[model samples]
Target chain A: MDLTLKIWRQASSKVKGQFVNYQVQNISAEASFLEMLDILNESLVAKGEEPVAFDHDCREGICGACSLYINGRPHGPDRGITTCQMHMRNFKHGETIIIEPWRAKPFPVIKDLMVDRSSFDEIIQAGGFVSVRTGGIPDANSIPIPRRNAELAMDAAACIGCGACVAACKNASAMLFVSAKVSQFALLPQGRIEAQERVQRMVAKMDELGFGNCTNTYACEAECPKEISVSNIARMNREFLSAKLISHKEF
Target chain B: MGKSLTYSSITKKIIMSLAGLFLISFLLVHLGINLLILFDNTYESFNTAAHFMATNPLIQTFQWVLFIGFIIHIIYGIIVQLQNWSARPVRYMKKGYSELSFFSKFMIHTGVVVFIFLIIHFANFFIVAKFGHVDEVTYKSGTYENLGAVVVETFKIGWYVAFYVVALLLLGFHLEHGIQSAFQSLGINHWRYTPVIKRIGTLLSILITLGFIAIPLVIYFS
Candidate 1:
């Protein structure tokens, strides 16, 4: 299928960017979205033009490396899947696709489609962990966790640090991301020891990082490739409130 | 965080919700009082109720607090919207974020309209009742500055009544999103309670709006 692409291009972070148009002919419908981009890049390289740079690793959606805002969606039109998982079959032949980078203030553009998502790493590093030094990876059976608790922990743990939540959000809020980490820790016995400190530090770091506040638009939950619940946000709010009320410690 | 509510986004949200909930609760009380007009022979009851509210000590204290609540809610709303606006200085080229309702996008627009409506409303009723000239009318019982008559006189203008009804509908729209959202923002949300809360919120918003609108309709038609 032939397709027209209007892709945002910039030389670097300091330079201005514009939507540059390109056409790729006779692309296979079975090709993944990234693969389509790969095909486009191959042609661009062959023609002695600069290849359109984008971020993709593993290409299987787990890595969360492929971040592209396709046709105004974080991961294209397909729900519950990353850009790499989306197929060209979802698009009609001769359709024009406009691709842009994730446009959050924190997640600055590194290149064409690659954004500096190190802000997420900083936020996670702020408080998203159990600080205790467990000597070994010992018996999981020793800790009697209820099935419901285990399930909820795993659900919160599903966040891949993809900035799509921020991208999809009108305010570019990272509440979903922060809440996922908060809920993951708060729900577990091992991580609950420092719950007060964890919730406080992470929220402070999130605020300091210039990420927008959640207004409960639920767009993040809708556009989430992992289908992370916004309920995690509510859970985080509870944790934050409880922590602030109970502890005299300041961050 | 410099011990300021504005410094923390969560606290700002919590404050917004608390003020919203206060305003929401007040709407119901106001609705109940306004609903008195629907009765054929309760004009004195309506004025007496209004007089009681105006003259009572506790209700008088609450009236000041209610004004403060409205002030805070509006101010915080502007602050949040401005912050949200600056956070995304670059707008999206394509329009595809229809995932959320128009309510989310146009909160400010609806809010500004409600504010305008509020100014006109307060000017028409609140100022007149408090400091403006009001005629003392005797309706077979006693002569008091008939607050009910003042209300009825205002509703007599056809377009004014129309504007009042339309503004109440907008208030309903605002409350529809505000009620459940305020609960969620204050960390009162749960998977079990959220759906139920949203339903109650919607129903309450519609009921209060209709209640207020019903008064204008009855007064205008009569």
Candidate 2:
């Protein structure tokens, strides 16, 4: 299949960026979206032109490294899949695909179709973990967690720290990502000790990072590659509220 | 703890949610009283209910609380929406499609329309009742401010009734999203119960929209 790509091009973060159109011919329908870009890049490099730059790792889709806003979606039009997993067959031949980087104040564009997502690292560093030191790997049965709680925690734990939620959200809110991280720990016995502190510190950092607030639009959940539930956000809200109103911790 | 409730995004939403819930409850009471107008052409019962609502000491106190609820809902709405707009300084070239509900996506727009309607509503009724004078209606018990007559007069205008119906429908749209959303913000969401809450939200929106619109239409056509 042949395709026309309207790609955003930027030399660096310091300069202005605009959409640059390029045409790729004789592409296979089964090729991954990233591979299609690779074909474009190979031709560009052969002609002594700079190739389009994007983030990709673990092309199987779990690394959360591939970030591309294709045709206005976070990871192309396919549901529950990252850009790397998106195949060319989703589009018709001669279709023009618009590709751009995640546009958020916190996740700034680094170059053509590549963004700086280190702000997520900053939020996770705030308090997204249990502080207690476990001597070694404990027996799986030792935790004595309920089946429901284990299932819910595992669901929340599936978050790969992709900024797609931020990109898809009308407000650019990180609540889904933050809430998933908070729920993954808060639902477990081992992570319960620091639940109060974890929610507070992480929320404070999220607010400080200038991420927008959730308006309950559920767009984040719709566009999530992992299909993470927004219910985790409600859990985080409950945790934050309880911690603020009832916790014995000193202000 | 260091974060202020006014400054924090989550806390601000909590405030907005609580205020919205309070306003929703207030509408229920207002709707019940407005429904009384349908019972009598002379407007005796409705006027008496209105007089009692205006004069009752506890209701008067709660009225102040209602105002605070409105103020909080509006102020925080503006603050959060501005922050949201600034979060995406550059607009997307292609608008994305999602399965997100239509009501959820346009809360700010619906809210602004309701606000404009509120200004007109207040001028027509609240200010007239509080600061201006209305003719008195006499019951066997005593004489009181004829608030029902004021409503009747306002509803009698064809364009005004049309405007009222339009505004109420938009308010209903706001409530459709606002009711379920407020519960989510307050951490009341669960897969087991969220569907139920959404149903109730839709039911309440229909009830309020039709209930409020009924009085004006009945009055206008009667």
Which number leads on lDDT?
Answer: 2
Candidate no. 1 TM-score: 0.96
Off by over 4 Å in 2: B1-6
| Candidate 2, B1-222: lDDT as tens digits | 233344678889999999999899899999999999899878788888888898899999999999989998998898899999898887778886667877877888889988999999999999999999899978897898888888988999999999899999999999999999999999888878999999999999999999999999998997
Indicate the residue-level lDDT of A151 in model 1.
Answer: 94
Model 1, span A1-251: residue lDDT tens: 99999999988899988899999999899999999999999999999998999999988889988889999999999999999999999999999999999987888888777889998999889889988665888676897788888898899898888888999988888999999999998998888898889988998888888788777888999999999988888888888888888978966
The candidates' DockQ values read 0.62, 0.77
Alpha-carbon TM-score of each model against the true structure:
0.96, 0.97
Q: Give stretches of model 1 more than 4 Å off.
A: B1-5, B139-142
* Cα shift from native, residue B205, model 2 (Å): 0.6
Clashes of each: 0, 0
Where does candidate 1 clash, by residue pair? none
